[model samples]
Target: MNLKVIAFDADDTLFINEPYFEEAEKKFCVLLEDYLSHQGLSRELFTTQVNNLPLYGYGIKGYILSMIEAAIKVSNGTISVDFIKKITEYGKDLIEKPIELIDGVEETLQALHGKYKLVVATKGDLKDQQRKLHKSGLGNYFHHIEVMDDKQEINYQKLVKRLDIQPSEFMMIGNSLKSDVLPVLEIGGYAIHIPFHTTWEHERIDHKVEHQNFSAVEKIIDVLKILQ
Candidate 1:
C-alpha cells in the first residue's frame, strides 16, 4: 500500500487517556456512592455526557460538568457545595496530569517520522490537546498537527486537501472506529483501528463491520508493519 500522509490520534493511541478519565469517574462515583449505587451513577453520568456533547464538545471540562450534573440529579439538589468543588479539583488534576506514552509509541513514531508525512489529527479542546502533545515530548516527530473540532468525513476531506494528497494516499490511525476509522474510510482513505483498553460510550459502535480499506492492529508497534 502506498501512503503519503499518515494522521494519528492522540488520546489512547499515543498516550494514556481513557484510563485517567475512568479513574476520575470512579472517584466521582464514590462521591455519589451514598446518593445512589455506583453502577447507577455510572449509567446516569454516561447519559449526561452523551446529551451534553453538543454543548461541551469533548474534554475534562465537559466531563467535570457532566459528573456534577449527575451528582445533582442523583442527590436531588441536596449534594454539598464541597462535593462540587472536589469534582472540579478532579478535573483540574486530570488536565494537569502528565502524558504517559502508550507502550512503543515513541519508538513507533521515531521509526515512521521521516519515512512518511506524519501528523496528528486528534479531536479535543485545542488547548488541552496542544498541551498534551508538547508535554509528551513527541512534538518534534510530526510534520503538522491538527486539533480537529470533529473527525467526520468533511474534516478528513479538508485535511487531505491541505496535505495535497489524494484520498488513497492518506491514512488515519486511531482507537475509536467512530471517530477515526469510518470517517476516513468514507472519504476513500485507508484507516487503522487500534482499540484501547477502555472506550467512552459515545465512541462505541453497534456492530463489528469490515471494509477493504479498514484494518486493525494490536498495538502502536504493529503500525510499522502496516506502513511497510
Candidate 2:
C-alpha cells in the first residue's frame, strides 16, 4: 500500500478513554437509582446522549447535559439542583482525567513517526480533544490534528482532500469499526481496527465488517507489521 498519511482516532485507540466514561456512567446510574433501576437509568442516559449528539456534538459538556436531562426525565422533572451539581462535577472530573496511553501506542507512534505524515483524525468537542492530545505528550508526533464533528464518508472525503492525498494513500487506525473503520473504507481509504475492550453503545456495529481495504489487529503495535 502506498500510504502517505497515517491518521489515528484519538480516544480509545491511543489512550484510556471509554473506561473512565463507563465509571462515571455507573455513578450516574447509582445516583438516580432511587428513581429508576440501574439498567433503566443507563438506557435513559444512552438514549438521551444519542438524541443530543447532533445538538451538542460530542464531549463532557454534552454528556453533563445529557445526564441532567436523563435525570430530570427519570425524576419526572423534579430532580434537585444539588443532583445537577453533582452531575456537573462528574463531567468536570472527566475533563480533567489523566491521559494514560495505551500499552504500545507511543512505541507504535515512535516507529512510524518519520516514515509518513501522522495525524489524529477523531471526532469530539475540539477543545477537549486538543486538551487530551496536549496532555498525552504525543502531539509533536502528528503533523496535524483533525477533530471532526462526526466521522462519516463525506468527512473522510473532506479529510483526504484537506491532506491533498488520494483516498488510496490514506490509512485510518482506530478502535470503533462504526466510526473509524467503515467511513474510511467507504471513502476508499485503508482502515485498521484495533479493538478496544470497551466501546460506546452508539459506536457499536451489529455485524461483521469485511472489505479488501479493511483489517483488524489485536493491538496498536501490530500496525507496524502491516505498514512496514
Candidate 3:
C-alpha cells in the first residue's frame, strides 16, 4: 500500500450535513407545498418533482430552483414573485451555514495529512462545496479538492491520471460504497469504505462482496493502521 494520493468524500463522510439539510429541507418543502396548494397544485406532484431533480444535478439551490420552476409551470404563472425571492434567500442561507465536521475528522485528517497527498473528492454545488471547505478549516490539509457533478468511472479515472498516480498507489477513503468504493476498485485503485452510522439516503451505496480492492471499517480513525 504505497499510497501517494488519498482522496476523501465530503458531506457525511467528514461532517454532519444531513442534519443541516434535514432542517432546511423541511422548511423548504413546507413553503413549496404551501405555495403550490394556494395555486391549486398537488403537493404530491410537487414533492415527486423536487425529489427527482437530483437527476438534473446535486445542488440544493438547483433543487429549490427546479422546484420553483415546477411550481411556476404547475401554477400557470400563479407563483408570486415574492415567494421566489423568499425561497432564493432561504436557499442561500442553507448553502452558507457553517458546517459541522464529523467526530474525529480533524484528528484523523491531521494524522494522514503529511503522510499522503490528501484530496477531497466530493459531489455538490461548486459554490456551496467551496464555501463549506473554506469554513471547515480542513481546507489547508488538502492539495486538491474536487467537487464533481457526478461520481463515475470516467471522473474517478481522470482524477487518478491527472494526479499522476498509478491505481495501486492511490487510495480513496470514503463513506460511500457506490461512489467511492466501487469506482475506485474498478480502476484498480485501493478503496477503504468507512461506513457512517447514519448514511444519508442520497449517499447510500450498495456493496458487493466480490470486489478485491474494497474493504470496510467501523471508524475513520482506524485508517491509520492501513496506511502504516
Overall lDDT per candidate, in order of appearance: 0.91, 0.95, 0.76
Error of 3 at 34 (Å): 4.7
Query: Per-residue lDDT tens digits of candidate 1, residues 60-155?
Result: 888899999999999999989999999999999999998899999999998998899999999878899999999999999999999887788999
Q: Write the per-residue lDDT of candidate 2 for residues 170-194, one digit (tens) a residue.
A: 9999999999999889889999999
Shift in Å, residue 91, candidate 1: 0.4
- Candidate 3: segments with Cα more than 4 A from true spot: 34-56, 73-77, 197-200, 206-210
Worst lDDT window (10 residues) for model 3? 37-46
In model 1, what is the error at residue 13, expressed in angstroms? 0.3
Q: Candidate 1: lDDT of 10? A: 98
Candidate 3 residue pairs that clash: none
Question: Regarding lDDT, does 1 or 2 come out ahead?
Answer: 2
What TM-score would every model get versus the actual structure? Answer: 0.95, 0.99, 0.83
For candidate 1, what is the lDDT?
Answer: 0.91
Give the clash count for each candidate.
Answer: 0, 0, 0
- Sort by lDDT, best first: 2, 1, 3
